[model samples]
Target: MTASHGNEIMVVSGASTGIGAATARELAARGFHVLAGVRRERDGDAIRGDGVEPVILDLTRPEHVRALADRIASDPRHRPLRALVNNAAISVNAPAEVLPLDEWRRLFDVNLFGHIAITQALLPFLHRSHGRIVNISSVGGKIAMATYGAYAGAKFALEAVSDSLRRELAPHGVQVVVVEPGAVRSEMAGRGAATANDLAAMMNPEQRRRYGGLIEAVVAHSLAFTRNGLPSARAGAVIADAATVRRPRTRYTVGRDAALLTRLARFLPDRVLDRIAAANLRPYLPRQGT
Candidate 1:
């Protein structure tokens, strides 16, 4: 939208808050016309600014996806798409069995399939410009902790999809990169804690008796993890680097935790990782009942 900006466009989903909003701003500052996708009018208004346009986007909705495609295709300047940052996600922490099937589907809708939909819709522009796809993954993708079945599962699936998509597009010059971020200070941490508590409350008495303490530990640990985690702007800068670098790596880790944990997951045996996870959560677990 500015004369100083280049004739290229970038799309960042979930631009309402957290890393999404930060990444949108980062891309805009770097001189790309960034289309920041938010789910609400106020969010769009909040994020819209010079060199950054806001699109009302809900990836799970085909109409929203189509509209975004149309918007890009109809750009008056015909700015070719330069990158698409798939960043929309929701976290639900509960035992695999405790989380109902519908909840799992809901998570997958946004985390996995929704990204697929967006990628499929915009692949043409990417192919045209030989642009890249930056998937916002998580440390959870590499290691699955207790009460992380749904969230970790979705991220793992996204990681796999990214690999396959990268291979599939490499011959055509399109790049696909995955950015795995450790805990970040954001509203997501609070929402994850609230969601875990809500699901725990809905469990049957026997279910609660079986997993109540563990759920509480996870909630407390997640809050602490987020409290001391990386800043959104820092994480966004890493993502922006991944998106714009001349020769980008296939994958990047936003924080030291993500880098170390992902490496540990690769070499350590499952039993070892299990022990490590338990050790990390032990301090948060509740003591003997009153």
Candidate 2:
């Protein structure tokens, strides 16, 4: 713990990599005591720094979640947690019709349920400090595209939960904010591409005959899009701002693409948006009956 680690504490989930890691570094640089939650001891060690305290936190596991809350509550030197960033999430890409129910459940387990569970566990500390809760969402939260349905669905639910939480916690002076980002450079994009390929590879003969090539092309396009995304550090800067700003907005759009797509979602009709989105897949769409 650094000199300032005693007074103001910020807990960031998924701090081992990507935006979460960058946010931990940024907040520590800004003089806030950052408790970075990672899944492994090695990850915790990797993120340790001047004002950052790395702790093992695996959202999918109840014991891990409980231990984190207990550790913070028991520590006399650390109290009144100022912020909680729910950034730990997994991306599973597949067409909704072909996606397994188990995968859907797993996605929600980490992206939605895990977030709610952690927030409930930490509510007491947050109330003591009138703290903020920043939920990391995505443009997919606003617009659902083909092949990314499962990921989008989880984000959509998160948006709804954040809305309800914000209103419910208003009287208690706890701010609940949603940070919707567009394509930001991170491991998630690469993982998404790999998952897409894996899913396609796992398809049965009939399923592969129907959608394999299309899935491969979509994954390639997704990888390219990710390659052009904003840096993770840029997103971290926005998250840090959202956490510390005196009067933070209820929702902060992080990337240029995020800002534009969110606006387009609001203005465009569903049918129009659907057509625009499908245009990209047109080339890869399989011919009828093969």
lDDT winner among the candidates? 1
RMSD of 2: 2.8
lDDT per residue as tens, model 1, 179-245 = 9999788899899999999999999999988999999999999999999998999999999989898
**Model 1 stretches astray by more than 4 angstroms:** 1-5
Q: Which has the greatest TM-score?
A: 1
Could you estimate the TM-score for every candidate?
A: 0.98, 0.94
Q: Candidate 2: deviation at residue 192, Å? A: 1.6
Local accuracy by lDDT, each model: 0.94, 0.88
Q: Please provide, for model 2 over 1-290, each residue's C-alpha lDDT reduced to its tens digit, 9 standing for 90 to 100.
A: 23244478899999999999999999998888788999999999999999899999989888988998997787767556889999999988887767899999999999999999999999999998889999999999999887888889999999999999999999999999999989888898888888888888878888887778678767776777778999999999999889888898999998888999999999999999999887866765556674
Q: What lDDT would candidate 1 get against the real structure?
A: 0.94
Clashes of 2: 0
RMSD in order of candidates = 1.9, 2.8
Clashing pairs in 1: none
Q: Residue 115, candidate 1: how far off, in angstroms?
A: 0.2
